[model samples]
Target: MQFTEDKSRSRMTLRSAVPKTEQKPERKQPVQELPYIKYFGNIYYFTDSIDCAIYCDKILSQVDKTPGNTIIGFDMEWPFNFQTGSGKTALIQLSSTIYDCYLFHVTEFKKLPKALTELLSHSNVRLVGVNIKNDIHKLSRDFPGINSTAMLNNCIDLRTQANITLNCKQNWSMAKLVNHFLRMQINKDKRVRNSKWNVVPLNNAQKLYAAIDAYVRITLVEMGDKTKVFQYNYENNTVDICINIPFYDSVEELTYILIKRHDLPIYVDKDLIQKLSDFSLQCNLDYYDNSTTELINHSKLNAAEVEDIIKDWERLMREETADYGEKGCASDEELFATAYHKLVHSPALETMLQLEYMYAQTVRQRVNDKDQQIKSLSETQTDEMNKAVDRLEEDMTEAEINEIAARHFDDQTLLQVKLTSELETIKEAQRREYREWVMQMLEQNQANSSLPTPKNSPLAPVPPGPIRETKEDRRKILQSVVLEESFTIHLGSQLKQMHNIRILSADVMDFCAVNDNEQISDTTPQLLQTALGLYSNDLCGLVLMTDSVIGSRLTKDFTEICQRSTEFHFPHIDDQLEIISNTAKKYQMESCNNRNSSSKHLQPGDVYITRHSNLSQVHIIFHMVSDDSLRANDINSRHPVVLGLRNILKTACSNDITSLTIPLLLQYEMTEEMTVTWCAKRAELVFKCVKGFMIEMASWGGSDLKNLQFLLPQGISSDVFQSLTGMLPSIFKVSNPLILKSSSIVK
Candidate 1:
């Protein structure tokens, strides 16, 4: 994959690239008749020297100061390598509509100039290119810290833009965009394309090739404004252009685009449009006249159902406009559009009801608490006032008190009124406090949880579960098992081992609590405290399964972690989420979120590890499957379980976890679906996978293992537990005697 060049450094001189005598090209006015008035006419090269970079900065400064919507073409170049791994970004090419192109020799400059960085990062500037994602990805990989800030913000990927605007089915390359938009072919010389960009003095041909690639992107954007018809001629690999007519993918899309661009309203009668809108909303599907047939087939509706929908549409379109306000207005169009967007995005009605129920229940609980507080305060007030009167009697003689009371009865009455008013004010303050609490709760509950749900979506049918495994079936599974490599699997109760994996049953929202008496942290999943208790300020960590979006409604352990991180001096807690997010970005992967596709699960399994200074250990958080993926009672699919195990082992091998513990049931909360039979089958699956994973760990970069313990859920029947253990002895055993003898003899 390596590219070879001359070993002699003398010939690869940086100064040699620069022309000895500077010759400025005379500027010529752009022809007014051309479709695009301006284009790249000349290019400047910046080498390793400070002088060339300063000149580049000056040229970029001028481009930055130029007028409205300054479109700049951007691209990166590097020597081709056969290996899939990325190579360094050797050159950066930028061209402006001002007809000036700049080639930055990245290897020579070593670092991007401050002015260039600022110009690239400027929010006002638009960076245009084809497949810019690849360029940005490569830039981040090559120059991490420098390019992390260069986020390609306000970037326009011409390929995507062309697909949206021109109905392009294939990815549009620079050459294709030029041929289609400019009605001209650009040179894509293969020899120059594969040239070594890292070579010190790039030749004139290389510079022209680099400059034109960036220049065309800028020119194409300008040409896009004019109304033109494009016809792709596959035979000749060219486009036939006609003025004033644009391509349309569909009637509906075209109609919507026209309405948006021209601010035109639909001329439909009100009554007809209202009925159609209502039907679309009721059906929870987007409405379009052309999509009726497609919807019927996709929804698996019967012929009668399809007829009903057609009749509904027909009745609405035929109705009169008298009942509604006006026809052919923007307001009517907006109403229909709003309904279309809502129906397209809304979840099933049942899910919406569940959300509403949760919100209502939260509000009710807050109100109930406030009522109790108000009652307690009201009852206590009379007793407190009587006690105060008794105290006043004890402090002053009866004769003196009577004399003062007789002289200032109005003052005494005013004092009593003031006390009563003060009490009412306090009660009002409590009511306001309750209202504020509810408002805060409402704000916090705005984000929906990504935790797995049991029900299937409207589009999908539930898959039937496999029949339970019988005793004979279990025996068959163990008898037919084969191993390619050996690893020891032991079952034990002691948690004292240095490299032991302990399993515990945990709740779905287990929060850890900090032990104030001895600095034992309060958190959910008391198992963590138990695990931490095994060490006295010694380094240890455990893996936790959690949601992709960390919610305000966290498990006790998670809440404790956040609380301790903030309230106490646990430094790791502060950066825990940031570390996980940054790591996810670095790996270009995340735990399954709602936006992820069903088939693309566990593509690049990620494990988020965070250190806890308070506990003096690290916590590895593993994301479970998304809400839609769960079967019933939060039981995740088998794929994420396997992925979690693989990620855990992979992370453990690379870090300082001497011992780790996990929940054997995969979850702390047990639903009715999690029966004894289900647990046994799941345990069997986990056992086989763990053995295979451990044996295969060496190839996957795994470290040595000392002890492995499997903990059964306390609820598992003793009979089923015995049976699960029985199958394991057949699969795992100590190392063979011959191997032990051979090792002893070698020693």
Candidate 2:
């Protein structure tokens, strides 16, 4: 059974292994290029200490002309080797305004000049870049003579600031930030970035890249921070006090975020945050706090943090408030894990507790009164929550239904999937049976009907190899089929009974649902037939025997196949299963109200029917629950599945399903224990049981019970099939026999 894998199949063949020189490179589809970032300004390239110092003086002078914190886009670049790691900072770019930019080639400088360092250290100047902090550290580290960190205290990271203004937290790049705010592309390619930056005179690409990195920061900050609310950090309980603060957000949302993120306290009051905000606004606290130091100078809280105490909060709360049928508190009533456990009680603690208890009682009574009022309000409306939405108009909007469905989407999806799976599993089996039957019938009738061959259509089907048969063969087949026996039999005194019997060595689905689209033609016949009988009185029914388990769960059976398949018609199978389970549970409860019974769950012989359309062959499915007794070696004619089958047959016959498929072994597949003898015995039990039911059918004649099929699972050997076949004819017994004369007598 084992063989070595042919690696050559996956590996490139010798013919495909062309030389690199011979290979013509594939042309990629052209992408529309975005416009590059352009800075329309005076670009000052500084090499020595002298020109750099001059640029520094120019920046310091021009920066504060705007009368506020002047934002200077700052960036640094250095030589980095993948192996040797980073070298000292080689170049730094700074731009105070869009028009003026300075690229300091510090690698050529003797040292960072006093004038340049002082200018960078100047107050009211904000340094901005994607990596502003790290770049400032590099600047200070490269030239330790200058205190770059202290001087560049007013630094704003582009990613952090961009996130604030854009009202979203996302991993942002300098190029992406520029694209989002400035609506232009800045080249951040690997080649340009990894280029030699420690060189003397930079190329056009390097010079432009260096200048744009610093220059775009200023532009982005100017355009992005137009929204007055700069930052509202819940973790720190702080909001940036911008000049034009947006105060239109929900106060409830603010309170929830504060409590959750800040870890303020779990015991949050309903309106605490709203009241404080209102008070601060009404008192004009900002006017008096005008002298507050700049840049997040709020006074820090004196801290000695306590460990969080809350645990099993719901359980503790329930115990603390549980009714003990007395006015005194029990030992279990104490709640140590509560938020207010270590807190001081109110001065009038007893009175407050009494008032709370009274209020709770009043609320309960009021709710009851409201329920009564709701019941009386309209004939359509009910106080029950589940029934409340039932009164919705038939023409309710999809959005409205979606709103309701969203609340219980998990439950609804489970139901839809289960039913859909069940339907599809049956449909798949039916479809397979149909294809095979069609092909077999075609091969048999090939002489009579010529199959059409569509010209040049690859998808068109062709017939299989031919088999010849003569007129004499057909005549003998007809004569033998004639002795298959008449359906009529004298069951009761002077009463003739006619009921058809059929045997199939296939699954149950084959008998119930016929393949509508099996012929070589348009699907018009199939669609028309399906449409007519889909919801008509001539409905097909199936007996889906399952385990004693109530719900239609997936096992290694048809239910599993159903749940695994993707095709199905949906109406929420979950609700149907739940309704059936609940009804069964209710019956058990009422029938054995005072008795100690084991029928709390669904047991043997429990039958529930589900209706379907367009999903499978059968319109109605009777899911009958049986137990392990059916699988027992000593099982008899009184087996639960057999009894359930009798009821199903009665129902199907009365309901006009003249022909029905029933599992002979009460199962769809052959198990390990299903040996030849096992199959024969089970076949005989079901056969004789069905034969008795047919004989009794004359008395309970509500409708004609024409055809009954004993379905053996597929994969049963030819021997087993023949055994069941012989048993069927022998047990049913021919009423009138055709006596063929001997050859000698005929002559």
List, residue by residue over 519-581, the lDDT tens digit for candidate 1: 111222223332333323233445455545532233235744433312111223534666655
Regions of candidate 2 where Cα sits further than 4 Å from its true position? 1-493, 509-538, 553-575, 593-596, 735-747
**Using Cα atoms with residue i matched to residue i, what is each candidate's TM-score against the true structure?**
0.32, 0.32
TM-score of 1: 0.32
lDDT of 2 at 3: 12
Give the clash total for candidate 1: 21
In model 2, what lDDT does residue 254 have?
62
Shift in Å, residue 84, candidate 1: 38
Query: What would the TM-score be for candidate 2 when compared with the true structure?
Result: 0.32
lDDT of each: 0.50, 0.57
| Deviation (Å) of 381 in candidate 2 | 46
Expressed as tens digits, the lDDT of each residue in 1-747 for candidate 2 is: 001113664211111112223345665332226677777766778788887787577566655443656667888899899899998888988876665678999886657888778767777776777867777877777786777766556666767655544445898888776565455787777888998999988877788888888888776654433322223444556533232222455666766765665456655535556554664454344433432321112121101111122335544665687563235543421332121121112222232222222322333344345445444543332233245356465556557656656645554455456644555455455434423433443444345543322223223445633445568657545533311212433344466565566566565544333232222222222223323354334666667777656654422244332232222233334445668778877787766734448656666776787655432355667888877677776788777667887888788777776656677778777889888888888888887888787777767867666655556676666777777777666666645657876864755
Highest TM-score, which number? 2
